[model samples]
Target: MDSTPGVTIDLTVADQDSKRFGSAPSPIKIGAVRMHGWQVHPISVASDQFDGADAYLVKFNYELGTTPDTPEMNWFELGVELREGVVVDAIPHHTQPTQTSVSYIVNDHLNLVPATNGVTPAAHLPATGETIHVFGVGSSGVRWQYWATSDTGVRWGSRVAWLVTLVDQETTHLDLTTIVRFDQRPTLDWNVLPAVTPADLRIELPTATNPRAEVTTQPANGTTVALLPSSPRVFISYTHDNNAHKQLVRDFANLLIKCGLDVRLDQFASPARKDWFLWANDNIDNADFVIIIASPKCLAVGEGKIDRNEHPGMHCELGIMRDRLQGNRRLWEQKLLPVVLPGESLSNIPVFLQPQAMDRYEIDELTEDALGDLLAAIHHGTEDNSRSPVVLMATSARRALADS
Candidate 1:
């Protein structure tokens, strides 16, 4: 084992002249690299030339090893310096992992199976001609670093490089996928360099999109378990407390949407002439989870302190939630979640919901890390097991006794 990570580059395609360049449909040159005892294989690299725009779209698909000896690849960067005649028309976007797998060697036998647990690294175009994607393995979240360039000197051609860094020791793999667009047909030569010192760079703590699905381990026998769908239908229930509060709720909903949740919020609905009450009720019934954002106005409406005519929409939603919970306590209890935003208080939760006795998610900030527990609950249905049925019944009985 080498203390310093070793790098090996392997060009998968040998006949470069055989492949036609520009206008004519041709395959992009694909290559592989082995870094830190793990193999970085380019599964496919497809390129499409624009009809008359003289532009091209390239999609890269790469898979890395996931064995125990595989080093933790913290960040991966793709850079393209355009030729004198070419220019970058658009920044790279739409980066996500398409698939993930795990490999285990047991009893001198090699077994490869699909893994349910994996993180989708966040992609950022921090600077021109540079796109960096990073993922974290532990509690400490992803750290982003970008380079500063004042080198505006004239150059004849551009250079493209793919850099991967192994910052820690962990057993995880990443299936990197991204699409890049160029104004003109550019060279797709990806040069892998060993540990070059980045110049004029600054490390910053940036927010990352939540993983598409929560991480789950496969059984020791290499049995693949069914994982939650990538996008869960989530409905956000909250009162129009104020302009600021409404904006906060909207921001939270947007964040959930970015995390791959099909979020349903009143703010996102159109202002067409229709029955708002029916809309609220229908979404509540159809949603995978209805997140009840805790606030003073929401508590007032849920507890009947506010007049129904004042906030008919919130009133209608609360009525539907109450009916569903009374109809099926166990099911609705798991589906209806009480959430307190950063500036909100837990005491603002509705009384009939048994806020004191049940689990409530407190969001510390408007970041993915703050919503980890809520996301996990939605993905794994763990909240349903948080409290036993017997315990819930006892809590209801206690509430009844207290009211008497």
Candidate 2:
């Protein structure tokens, strides 16, 4: 099945929840698959923060009937800024009805009977959504369904929502059933990924304003699995050099974003009233990778050549990074990425990082080869090859000593 095209949602920021209930006053897009009508009950969880809870408990109504078992889930995104340098995700919600859910037997045919890839119980399925197929076990037996959704064209994530009527008010009997056997579905060891930015919301599709639904983007071609892998959090380190160098770094960061990485550059960090030095330290600790842009100005601080009172933010950050690398040899090899700009002398590498293996951008542009290498290094898994650089250096030293 062809993938469903996505609709970008515009999110408005409100200082307070006015309890208004028309068109979703919040920048959040909710409700997918309009049956008859459903209620949006605002339920408080441990924390309303995106990390812990949702804006509300939106219960989709009606049973999976003639409408099409291949249902489209709703895409949601709230643009309200909770704080500086922090981002939230536009989450697509779809699950089995609370009152009724049944397990379906796994069938390997047509990506059905998923022997390995885990299956999620979906109420709104597509007759043909994506290339993969969905099967739900019913009281009688199991059956397959096709589903599809659209892409929002957003670099990170796609956001949209749908609506339906109240099924209870309808005269026809609603059927809520499922066959769910967790162990028989896909494996749970899939990678988890962070959410991306939503697409522009101005685009609209001509459909009955009341009954509509959105679906999650299938993971890949020929297979449908959970969207679990997250982009690594990369902290970009650079000096407050001339606009040219700064622009270069900014462009580099944008390229990383395009390549599916959560870049934490200082400009985007927006330290606000926070102590800039302290902010750098905290950002470094939280980041999965720290990229040090090698330039004359950037190297000055790392080399401790600049006076403490003059401007030590970068210097201080370098100190913190070096200490982190020294303390955790394992993290140093994996987390620290030393990048040099075009025309930068080899000696200009940060004094603390000179001994470390590094990569340089050959041209002024973000080359595919350079980007690929950086990405590979940043997102490398901790498999049998998880040996740190220190370990490799030590082993090489032993070999040399024995030869001598």
Candidate 3:
């Protein structure tokens, strides 16, 4: 074991880990993880996209070698495996919180490592002859895989990072914040969970906030668990800028509803007595399809419109759509529909929505092509990618775990 502070002791040679990882690298590359740390830093990042959810996300970052001399070569990769929620919230040591989390760059790719040292480094796991016993802090491990740049020549490692939301979870101490390195993985049992490195580093911790699990499930903070009817529902999102244009959206909703769709419209879903914001969000959260009648006024309200703004209701609907479909290409393809109404330039569409295929129809010369496409797309039910078909990590669950 290297006596250097924060250095991980190298264990078991090439053959085993190579086979475990399905690679046959040399002994030098397999063991003796040179350097990693929970060294903290603040970064500007969007708060966990699904806000006000119970799940918390934390990032673990570290540097390679002791200096900039560490050789990060091609096909050389660094990844991390940890129980979800093990990375509870933390304000990176310095600077104000700006949706920050730990992060680093190994070679050119973003890489992940452990946050706390209480978790035993693989080198410290029980050896073959010892009584192997280990338990998990999370229901499953979260793995972030990274690969080296084969094309570029060897480069020194960059400080790695994870910009994650704060989370809270029940925790157990394996001899409270102990750092252990073992030769092999211990046979794990529930009674004794795996250990973690203590928060030994002297980075000032920020004031702990409420656990993400306790987050509010409202339209503003955001939640994905929909609240709409099971029927294929469509949400008419538009602006009331022009009287005739507003009627067009109303007519559009009526058309979809007449075709056996449960269409939710502003004037229809929101009675004057009802909270339009909440009503719009309900459909945005639950509706099967969202047809944005892309217009300058509608697009302006998407983000430029805020809480007290005239188009706050429209902003809520469109903003929620952006959050829900952030990285989900599958759902974006199914759940969101943008139609260019007459006299509205494509520039009216938000930058995020611009790349999407839009259905074009003029209010004065309305055609069936755009409307027909919208109908067909929404009729095909939204695909639930929530189920992890394999043992792989479920992003939804991980996301919740992330912010929790």
Candidate 4:
């Protein structure tokens, strides 16, 4: 099947009872191969981080391979998936203006794929399938783990990536856009149902001019379904001891994905699973914000045979992202971020989440004006009241405070 126009017919070695392409070992040192394109911006409704919410948070990516002639050991990985759509509103008059019905539904025989790599191995699931049937509205709902991927030697072969968490009940946030597609069908149609247009949806983010999803009824360019992104979706809690601090936290998450932001890492775990600390806590509990690299052998606790705790695997992954951000709303006690390396200590975190703590971001003192002032304090730190830079001058001074 290597006819190789855009390839996707490997079909796991024509299934002669495949055991990883009959036992992986070729040029396969497999590390750097990436191409991007993603969008899952809804960082806070119940809140997580990245403050910018308009909705429809999930768009795939491309070009995951075909550059790796040692393109710096090939490192590009972005994956995101949310296989649950059809959450409707506008049924109040329902006369079919742009057509919106189905007052109740959820996973109507759900089976669609291509969120991105990783989760495609439940017998390769018909090579990344996409939308067969899903219909719901009114009470609109979907969260049964239909899809998710993007982290495993940073991905290759196929791409559409999704893995952002602060406390996912079915994907919280993940925006990745890296187009190059020669073809594997991801030109996107997904059997219609409100596809594309939110500005040609490729979602890597941050250029903002505000034409990113706003269709009250219809026709600005038509098609609707986007309601997610409050801002602050970052999670990087490392410890493989030291591959130079995991390449300095993966070049500090590729400079916050080149300052558009939407990063997630733990070296993309999943080495055919040996319980990599329970699969890196299922992608660090769907991060809104959690970055801990406070080393001293990760805050030492053992040292004889080499069980030096590493702050109990980052306090058991920040206690499962603070118990799933207290079931969504306490936003993990106001979005956690700590980078206190260089001989650690802000008393080693946890002084009630360390009072707005995001200590001087030490990667031996990195700067781009300290990562754009820590990405503008993670897009204006939590409870983002529509990203208050004074809420658009308090809604344009509410008619001069009600005409004095």
Distance from true position, residue 110, model 1, in Å? 28
As for TM-score, the candidate ahead, 1 or 3, is 1
lDDT of 1: 0.45
Looking at candidate 3, the ten consecutive residues that score lowest on lDDT are 122-131
Better of 2 and 3 by TM-score: 2
Instruction: List model 3 lDDT by residue over 254-311, tens digit each.
Output: 4453344555665432111345557777877777777788787776676474344676
Better of 3 and 4 by lDDT: 3
Candidate scoring better on lDDT of 1 and 3: 1
- Per-residue lDDT, model 2, residue 319, is 83
Candidate order by TM-score, decreasing, is 2, 1, 3, 4
Tell me the tens digit of each residue's lDDT in model 2 across 99-174. Answer: 1222221111111121223655222222222221121110111112112223311112221211111111111211
Model 4 lDDT tens row, 1-404: 01112212111001111222334222222122233333333322323211222233332334433334322212222222222222221111111123322121111011111223322111111223311111112112211111112222223455332222222234322222221101111112211111011111223222245333311111213322232332355778755455556556666665564444556664432222145457557666665566665555544421222343434565566556556656874665545565654444445444434434434454345545666655666777744554433233223223222332
Cα distance off (Å), candidate 1, residue 3: 61
- Return the top candidate by lDDT: 1
Put down candidate 1 lDDT per residue, 1-404, tens digits, no spaces: 11323333332212222211212223232333333332221111112211111111111222222223222222222322211112111122222333222221111011112223353221112223422222221111121212112232111122222221211112122322221211111123521111221112111111123122211212345333221222467899998878679768877876675565657776544223347778888899989899999999998998889877777778889889999999999899999999999899999999977889988999989998888999999887633345533234234323332332
The 10-residue segment of model 4 with minimum total lDDT is: 190-199
